[model samples]
Target: MIGILAAAALQADAPVEWTALQQDNIQVAELAYDVGIALAVICRDDQLMVAITGLPDPAPGAKFRKLEVNIPGAELQASTWRIQGKATISLAPAVYARRLRTADHLTVRAPAEEGEPARRYELALPSDHLALDQTLEACDVPLVLETDLTYDPTISAVTWATSPRITPPNRLPPGGYAEVVLECTVGARGRPENCRAIREQPANSGFARSALLSIRTGRLGLIDGGPPPVGGVFRTRLTINVVN
Candidate 1:
């Protein structure tokens, strides 16, 4: 069964924190910031790659389809991996080590699907250069970049909804309970969409189904005049301890 997780606002100026996670044999160093934007550097199979999320689909027949980074006195372009809503660019480890050390911002300019003028998306470097340098070293990349300003996200408010009703399975033990975890993407309109269960205790338990149904029917509300929703992500946990 699916469940609703708590909703939290993502800050725009949030301090950049690099986190490393392993997927299969690949090592991914990622930083999420500025309203759904995720920047990641991946190392796998003797190759290095960079990816950025929150980009719109590219227009057909577009001639210039690549990512651009602004460094001191130079602009660099590389072949881009175009997906539905995000883009990635492959980089040699040596090249990445040099560019990431000096680049101030990464930008993407792509034509809108509806033929509108190209839009430019840019993300600034985090102020904590030392930490970023450390992260780069951990990834086996050299650190040559430095910055002095520190920034953190300006969070508005976090709101919660009433717990959903859970129907216990008939065959459960007298005091046994099940738990489910859900990940949801909250839309700009403050509605929970694209919710899915990520983990569940007790395989094949019916609690997951009940949790999803309740979330689909439940409403999540945000505070008035709060920072406009940034299409951020949130998680919720649901537990069913009572029997029908």
Candidate 2:
């Protein structure tokens, strides 16, 4: 029927473009390949996770704790808790992101033991990747006090009374993602002020503005234990990857 055909043409899912969401300052995006596999990039609370799911099961009696991964220009190892059907693997987010952003395909070899041959599978990497770019660009950093002491300047330092909640900027492209870095000065009570968006991948994408506004509404100060950090905290570099 023409009606059915028209409805199918407007399907919400697409292979080339990824879907994304934001919650509690966490960014998440996922894309699916035609070959029964899906990849997800989860950015949360200062950690990044890449999950590859819906993998073919290993042969019975085989065992593995890691997967051998091959993508354009690189060969590496991936850790996974599930080694059987629908296995999920975790690799270095930075390394995987670098490849995912540009590579056309990824090959994975399952570990085989006791003279068994390794099973191999290939995954197609989608190209329209804006959803992922924005997720990585989004940030949730806790501001701390600046000081100078021989040993413990932050004898009783503090941080945000409540953590900031951030979202993707309105100016991001439909399927284009971005990266942004910010350096914020702490004002009274550890409120972030004068935040300088030190970096933005696409230049004026609005990612920086969203992060700064959210930070201004919150406060930052010390670790929960009130103990000085082993190494003084001033700056940190957080890089990320995506699914868009």
Candidate 3:
């Protein structure tokens, strides 16, 4: 029985103290709350609390606060890995205005009518938190941290890349080689929204462009709840035989 107890104690996960983000006298454009830099974040038994170094009155020009939390992925019962938590933040207009912008990019396109400044289509977060729990199971640790920043919905461009590839036409002269890279942007919906070729290789440009298009069409498995604030890319070199 003692062995079981010892093992249980060993198996118990320790709370993660993300001390790296602690700071002081910081200016918050979102919330009326003033926060100093030094911060003390404690997590234990599925509970979390953050104590900032300073809390001042809302600045005249400033309206809200951006509460930044870094969530870390962990190993569950067996091969299963997951992350779970709850965040109760103050989201008044003054406090949330700045925080929302911090969430993702808010673009303003030309309005349908003449007098309108523009139209806004804000990114949507998943309504299902349970789904988010499942998707995080297979994602890397960095992904969890990245997702936390996305919750605010005020973020802009989220980006990640893969390796490069090389493909050559079989009919090429004796000496022939090709290598190129394709970069793309994933929209808030967890799919490649845009793509661009970075390297210049005339022979492989066409092929690269096609491959980039394929990537743009591909979908990324996301937390069922919503799209993250950032995008991810898979880059690699490919060798395709050219038919001459």
Q: Which candidate comes out best when scored by lDDT? A: 2
Per-residue C-alpha lDDT of model 1 across residues 1-244, encoded as one tens digit per residue: 0000001113465456665656575665656666546666666654555655555555554322444444222453423333322343432334443454466665555444566665676666554444345445556664543321110011112344533456565566445888777767776456557878776667677767767776665445642213325576656666777645
Q: For residue 120, give model 2's deviation from the true position in Å.
A: 2.6
Ranking by TM-score: 2, 1, 3
Error of 3 at 89 (Å): 36
**Tens-digit lDDT track for model 3 on 83-107?**
1121122221222222232333222
In candidate 1 the C-alpha lDDT for residue 200 amounts to 68
Candidate 2 regions off by >4 Å?
1-14, 57-64, 71-87, 113-118, 139-244
Off by more than 4 A, model 1: 1-14, 60-64, 71-85, 91-97, 111-114, 127-244
Which has the higher lDDT value, candidate number 1 or candidate number 3?
1
TM-score of 3: 0.23
Q: Which 10 successive residues of model 1 have the least lDDT summed?
A: 1-10
Off by over 4 Å in 3: 1-179, 200-205, 221-244
Question: How much is 112 displaced in model 1, in angstroms?
Answer: 4.5
Better of 1 and 2 by lDDT: 2
Candidate 1 TM-score over all chains jointly: 0.40
**lDDT values of the candidates?**
0.51, 0.53, 0.31
